[model samples]
Target: MSWVLGNLDVIGGHAGAHLLQALPAIVLAFVLALPVAKLAGRLGVLRGGISTAAALMYAIPSLPLFIVLPIVLGTSIRSMVNVIVALTLYGLALMVPAAIDAFRSVDGDVLRAATAQGYGPVARFWAVELPLAGPVLLAGLRVVVVSTVSLVTVGGVLGVPSLGMLFVDGFQRGITAEILAGIVLTAAIALALDGLLVLAGRALMPWASAGKAPAEPSPAGAPDPAAAAAGGAA
Candidate 1:
């Protein structure tokens, strides 16, 4: 506790560095996943191959990935780029399946209705499919957020600056407080990110908000006034 209290600036700098690595990974994975997922949803044959490859990519251990990515990327073993790229790959692995499910969950009937209303491919995708897919996509994104933040610590093993560095230093010096501080701050950052995502989802997709009171039953099904009005208009 005393060590953590005295090294506030050190902790803050590590946390900031941690976010820089994690956020870019999370965002890039999501952006890249959407197109891959859409393509997978459209083509049944490639979906299996993509899924298998993603699984294999994710199964690679983080520490080894940290050591190896530099060779592939032509960077130093301790480069932050290696950490970000590794995390991005992991994020994409998790997100692609989730995104595939999200798009598949949208109703075919709704899309047909959208087409009937003269919506072109791009407009329909942006206005209809994406909005309808928002809830499931958001769920996947939250998982990526937590996973990326936690995994940033793995880079510390390669001497990269992050909250994970606290773990390495604390273990070396036999200081439990520093390790505990790292664990607590990592969790707090994940929770904060998750809360913000939830709030943003609610703001952008108000229709998807949970826990709304059900509409009152129409007094023993008295012809459903709303349905009667629709019938008259038709």
Candidate 2:
């Protein structure tokens, strides 16, 4: 514990590096995903292809992705950039499918109503579709964030002193405290990011859960007029 407190700099640096490494991937992944989702929704082509590719990308060994980048891009390999690129590729692959699912989950009626009200594609997306889709999108993002938090440590194998690198170092040097620190930090970051995603989702789509279960019909064919009238009429 004393050692942990003493090495605040190391812990802080690792945390910052991890966040730096991940933020780009998360944002880029979502941005890339949104359009691919829209395109998939519009064209209805190769969705399985895109998702399978993402799953394949996920299955890919991260070390190899890092290795190929330096070989192909020729060794100007900034760990930050490599991590982001690797993350983005994996991110896009996973997220596009999730995004499409979220978008599809929105009420069809809401979209149709928006369409009837002279909302164009862009307007409708901004005004209606996105609003309804927010909860699902956030749920997927939370999954990605949690996954990325753990997977990101793999980036350290490439020489990024990312959070994972700490654990790697701890293992290499047989430092139990450092290894524990890394695990604890990673878990904390995952929880924090997931919480933020949930808050954002609630803010974006407050109405999605507003009408949880509709009122049941009266047992009689006609609602009781007295009861209905008292309750502001059926």
TM-scores of all candidate predictions against the true structure: 0.91, 0.88
Worst 10 residues of 2 by lDDT: 70-79
Residue-level error in angstroms, candidate 2, position 7 = 0.9
lDDT of 1 by residue, 53-131 (tens): 8768789888888898999999999889999999999999999988998998899999999999999999999999999
Question: lDDT per residue, candidate 2, 1-234, as tens digits?
Answer: 776888899899989999987888898888788888877777666766766666677788878887788667565565577777888887876787789888889888878988998999889988888777777778778777887777788887666778887888888998888889999999999899988888776786678667676466675877866677888843
Q: List the residue pairs that clash in candidate 2.
A: none
- The C-alpha local distance difference test score for the whole of candidate 2 amounts to 0.81
**What's the residue-level lDDT of 227 in candidate 1?**
79
